[model samples]
Target: MTTHLRPTDLRYLRLVRASAWYDLVVTAGFATPWTYALLHDALSALGRAWGLGTLPPLDPIQTLYANLMGSVVVVWAVLRLARPLPLHGLLDGTARALFTGWQAYALTQGAPRFLWLFLAVEATFAVLQLAPWYSPFRRPAVRE
Candidate 1:
């Protein structure tokens, strides 16, 4: 498979893996209660440090949802990191775009200013992953 791949394909694969690594690093803490506790503490401390007040502690259900999101994203990231292809980039881009939309909506509903950071990162990855398709000089991606 490597022998048949072009240079552009290699670059695309690298991009996909990079995105996956980002996901893993950003979301891995959400996957378990202990990690989420640490993450929540750190975030709250950061919020206080930034002069933004902390919110109420997360309830069990909310924690469950966070855990679910973290677990799923981490697993998906691992899969892409281990076996990235152009298709993975396209799909991950689509997912990130959706995430960006939802995250924006959450902000509009007054979730938190902290979410802006995540939203920005998601939007960046979404564009990077999807932009090749819209480039005028884009080559057709090799089929998986």
Candidate 2:
């Protein structure tokens, strides 16, 4: 079946793909590394404060979590690039939910300094993802 997308839809798709790439680069360059370091430092500090002789090395589990999350984000980005309008809504919703979760976790953790950076990234992604759905930029569906 042939498919078509309106200009608005096409714009949104490009924005979504760009946003996802932005996320991947930013996370790999800053977010993930800084977070890993911060968590490692925090855990080590906690151990020191508790008078433990030696702190364990950074938790592999935590590193795995970050890697998995990053992988998922990359996958999402690739999907957006490959299948733009067809799955736009789903990706947008997913990004929103993930951002909301990050926000909640950040707040619960008393707003760690790094979280603000993460929030900024997440917010950008959310805005780009949701732009097409907004009243001013909504796109009409295609017909066969």
Candidate 3:
């Protein structure tokens, strides 16, 4: 079957696909043991600077699992973004939004203040990913 995508849809696909590279970099950083330590150290310093005291140690198994999950997300996003599909952004955006919301709640309840920075970044990207769907100027829906 042939598909005729609007210009905006094509633009969105390109944007999201390009973003997958950034996600891969970030996911790998968090997934790799050595790189994760760097992130942990930076987060510890941020916490100390914010007067939150030393950060707790990460459980190795949990961290590894979390990294694996992130890696999976990266792969999923890459696959979804590879095509000029209109709704693919929904999955990535929703995932980020939900995760960010949970982290925001946790931060308020006692997660390190430093996590706020990460949450901010996540929220920003989530908005960007989801915005096209909600845009007033978006072209008519793609017919499958």
Model 3: colliding residue pairs: none
Tens-place lDDT per residue, model 3, 76-100, is 7668656635566667777889989
TM-score of 2: 0.59
In candidate 1, list every pair of residues with a backbone clash.
none
Sort the predicted structures by lDDT, highest score first: 1, 3, 2
lDDT of 2 by residue, 1-144 (tens): 423333355555676667666756655432365666675576557555765432346567767776667667666666666776636644665666687787878667654344455577677666656555555665456599
Best to worst by TM-score, what's the order?
1, 3, 2
Clashes of 3: 0
Model 1 residue runs over 4 Å out of place are 1-8, 135-137, 140-144
- Give per-residue CA lDDT, model 1, range 50-115, as digits (tens): 866565597898789989999999999999988998888889999999999999998888665787
Off by over 4 Å in 2: 1-8, 28-57, 134-144
Per-model TM values vs. the true structure: 0.86, 0.59, 0.69
The TM-score of candidate 3 is 0.69
Top TM-score prediction, candidate number: 1
The clash count of every prediction, one per candidate, is 0, 0, 0
